[model samples]
Target: MATDQEPVLGIDLGTTNSACAVVRDGRASVVRRGDDRIIPSVVAAMSDGRWLVGTRAKKRRSVDPVNVIYSSKRLIGRRFGSAEVQEMRQRVPYRIVEGKNEAIMIEAGGKVVSAVEVAAHVLTYLRQMAEEALGRRVRRSVIAVPANFTDSQRSATRIAARLAGLDVIRVINEPTAAALAYGYIEDTDRVIAVYDFGGGTFDVTILQITRNVFEVLATSGEMFLGGDDIDEAILGLMVGAFEQQHGISLRDNPVALERLRAVAEQVKIQLSSQSGAAVHVEEVLPGQRSDLDFSLREADLRPYVDPIVRRTIPVCQDALRCAGLSPHQVDEIVLVGGTTRLPHVRSIVEETFGKKPQTSINPMSVVAVGAAIQGAALMGSLVPMADGGVSAPSAAASAVLLDVVPRSLGVHTLGGYVDFIIERNSAIPLEQTRFFTTTTDNQRFVRIQVCQGEDEVFENNLKLGELVLSGLRDAPRGEVTVAVTFEINADGLLEVRAMDKETGQQQVATMRVLGGLDDQEIEQMATRMASAGPGPSSRGGTVVSR
Candidate 1:
C-alpha cells in the first residue's frame, strides 16, 4: 500500500478499458479489485433506473444494445454534424441525436443522455474502485488522455472528473505519460518513440529524455483509427462469410449484428495469441435458426489487417521526419495499448524499429503506472522506484516534465485566412500576445474568432469559438489597438485574455465555445450529481454557455 498521508491516483481513461494506479514508498502500482485489474469502459442503464458499469455494462452491448453505450469516447466532444459522429450514427446500434448547440447526445434507457454524463459515470466507477482498493478517500487524480485530444475534449474530460468528485490536478498525454513511466524509473537519457495504438485512436510520439527532463520533439496521430477499426475489419469478414453460408445478411438486423460484434471482438482477442480462432454464433439471424461457424487463420487474417497496419507506418514516418531522425536513429521504441498485442502488428513494429520492441511491461496498465508516478512527483514524494534503476539520484529525486501543443492556435483574419498565434509543437503553459486594430470606425468591441490548426485559410482550420473584447474607446479604423493573448496550460486547455493597448485596462473575455458545455452548464450538472448523492447516475448538458 502507498504510504502517502493522502494518496493521489492516476487514471487511464481508455476507450475500451480503464485502470487506476498509485505510487507508494517510491513504487508505483496499479490499484486492482482482486483479479479485476482492468475495467471495461462501458456503461449501461438497467430497467430499474439504476446503472451498471465495467464488465456488467459491457455485456449489455449485445443483449440491450440500445441501452448500452460503448465507444462513447469516440463521440464525446464531437459535434453532431461532424463526419465522425455522422458515420457513428449509422454504424452503432444506439441512437446519437443532435441536442442543443449541435452537441452529441446518446439516446439510452428511454431517455436522452449527454456524452459527458456517460463519461462521468465511467470516471465515477473508476474513482470508487480506487477508493475501495486503497481504503481511503481519493479526491484528487491525474487523468491521461490521447496526445491529439482537442481543447474541447480535454475540457469535457475535466468536467467529467469534477462530476465524479475528483479534482484533476493535471492532464497529460498518453504517450508522454508512458514515456515518463519508462524514463524516470530507468534513469536513462536517450531518444525514444512511443507508438500508442488504442481502442479508438492511434498516435506516434518522439521524445528526447534527459536525466530528469522529458521533452516531446514531434507527435502525429489519427484521431479515429485503432482496435475498433480492426474489429470492424474482422467483423466484415464474419458478416461476409455468414451471409455467404446461410444466404442471409445480418447487416440490416441490428440485434443480430450486435451479437456478431461481440463474437468478432472475442475472435480478435483469441487470435492475438493463437494462429487461428473459430467463430460460432447460434441463431444469428432474426427469427431464423441459423448457425454461423467458421475459422480464421492468422495468414488469412493478415491480408485484412494489412491495410490498417499499413496506415500506421506513414504516421510513424511522419513523426520521425518531423523529429529529424531516421527509423534507426531512435535509441528505443515502446508500444502502448492492448491493440499492440497482435503478432503482425508486433512484426510491423519490429520491421520499423530494426529490433523487437519492448513487451515485458503490461501495455494496458503501463500508462496508468506512469501517470501515478507523475501524481506522486507533483505531491513531492516521487523518486526512483524501490528497485533502483534510474541514475542521477539528485535530479531523479525532483523530476521535471515538459510537453508540447499538439496543433496550432490562431484567429480568423480578413480575406478568410488564418493568422497563427502559436504554432504546432510549441511548448505549453505558453502564451503569446498580438495587437489587433479595429476594422471599422467607432467600433466599441471587436469579436476575435479563435481557431486551432495549421492551415492558412480560415475555413480549413477548426473554429473553437469567438472571444468578445468589449469596453473599447471609439476610434477611427485601424486606430484603436487591442492586445489579445492566447494561453495554453500544461494540459493543453486554451484560455484567452484581452486588454486595451492605450489605457492598459484588462477587458472581459467572453468565449462562446462551439459544441461542449460551458462553465455554467458543467457547474449545474455537477450540482445535480451532488444532490443525487451519486451511485452511477447520468447527467445531461445540452446548451452551450458563455
Candidate 2:
C-alpha cells in the first residue's frame, strides 16, 4: 500500500490523445500540464537522434512526414502480415517493415523501432507530466484500454507502461471506466450502456451497476472503426475532387497526404459545430503547381460521416442482445470518447437508445478520472466529496469490479475442431479446466494450441499461443490424462497451466503472444533510452498544436 500523500495516477492512453488524473484528499481532478489536459499521442524522430512526443511531434508531421509516427495504436499488438497492417502501411507516411516474430516495426529518424517503443515514448511523456504536476514521483497507475482489446493488445499495453516506468496496478476497459466515472457520483443501481467512440476504435459495453459493483454483461466492437475512418473518407473525397480539378494525382506524395490528413481532421471537427467548412491547401503539390480550395457543407459531409456512425448501431444492438436487455431497459446511455462530440453521433446515439445521452463530464477525461478514483480506492486513500463524485475510501474500499472476457477461449482438439474451455462473456477472476489424453499410443508430450474467438474452425480464430506438456509416461492410447487450466484475472489477463493428473507434475508453458515486447527487448530498450537521456523537454502548458 502507498501512503496517502503518494497518489496513484489514472491514465487514459487513447488512440489520438491521452490524459491523466488523480484523486487527492476527498476530490478527484484531472492532472493538467498547465491548462491542457489532452495530449496528442504522436511521436517524431529528431535530427539529433532524440524523440519528440505530443504536440511537438504532431507538428513535425507535415515537414518530416516519413519519420513522424501517429496512430501507432492501430499497429500495436498486430501482426506485420495482417491485412490491417498492410492497410496501415498504405495509409501512414512512415515506413512499416516486418520484424522478428512477425512484429511490426517502424523506420523513423533513421532507426527502426517497434510499436511498443513508440507507445512507450508517449507513455513516458505522460508519466513525466503527471510527476511534474503532482510534484511527486508518480509510480503506480491504472491504464484504460478498449473493452474488446485482444490478449496480445492488453499484454503490449502493460509492457508499454512498464517501459514508461509506471507500475500498472490494473487495466480496465474504457467503457467500464466511463461507467465508473458516471456512477461514482451517485449511489443508485442501474443498467447503463457505454458507447465509446474514439479516434481509432469503437466499443459498446453493457454493464449492470449495483452500488459500487460494476459487472459487465456483454461487450462488442470493431477494432478498425472510429474517427480516423471518417477522416479518411473525407480525405478520399478531397483527393478525388483535387485530381478531377488539377488533373494530377497526389496519392503517391506522402508529405502532401500527411498535410491533407491534418486538414481533413480539422474540417471534420469544424463541420461538427458549423453548417459548413472551407478546405484550402497552398502548394499542395511539388514544384508549387497544384493547390486545393473548396467548400463542404455539413450536408455534404454527412454522406461520409453517416455511414461510419451508423456502423456502430449494429454493434450496440449486438451487445444489448447478448446482455439480454433492450434499449428501453437501460437506465442511462453514457457517451465517451472525443468522437462523441459530433452532433450527428450524438443524434444517432439518442435515436438508437431512445434516451438522451449523458455528456456532463468531459468525454476525454472521464476514463482517466474513473481510473484515478479506482486507484485511490485500491490504495485505501479515497475520500468523500461534496461534488457528488466518489465517496470516501472507507465506503469505496468495499466496491468490487467484476469484468468479463470479451472473447471465447478454446483449444484445438482432434479433427481441427475448437473445444471451448471458457466461453466469451464469462466472469473474470475465473478458472476452468478440461482433461485431454494422447491420441496415439506411447505418447510422451501433448501440444496445446490456445486461441480466442467464436469461430468453430480451430485455425479461423486468433491464435493466442501454444503450450506443450512433456515428460508424460509413455502408455497406450487414452491411458494418460492431463488437466489444462485457463484462468483470467480481475484485470482480464489470461494465464494457462497444464498438469499430469497421473504424475501430479505441472508445467506452465510460455504463451508466445504477439503485440508486446519480450523481456530481453524491453530491457534493451530501457537501457538504450536511459543512455540516450531524455528527449526535448516541453512543459505541459504549451498550446495544443492540433
* lDDT for 252 (candidate 1): 86
Pairs of colliding residues, candidate 1? none
Predicted candidate 2 versus true structure: per-residue lDDT over 360-427, tens digit per residue: 88888999988887887677634445675654444554466767788899989879989998998777
- Which stretches in model 2 have alpha-carbon errors above 4 Å? 1-4, 184-189, 210-213, 229-257, 267-304, 381-398, 440-442, 473-477, 514-516, 539-546
Q: TM-score of every model?
A: 0.87, 0.85
RMSD of each: 5.0, 4.9
Residue 452's lDDT within candidate 1 is: 85
After superposition, candidate 1 runs with Cα above 4 Å error: 184-189, 210-213, 232-257, 274-304, 381-397, 475-479, 536-546
Poorest 10 consecutive residues by lDDT, candidate 1: 537-546
| Candidate 1 accuracy as TM-score | 0.87
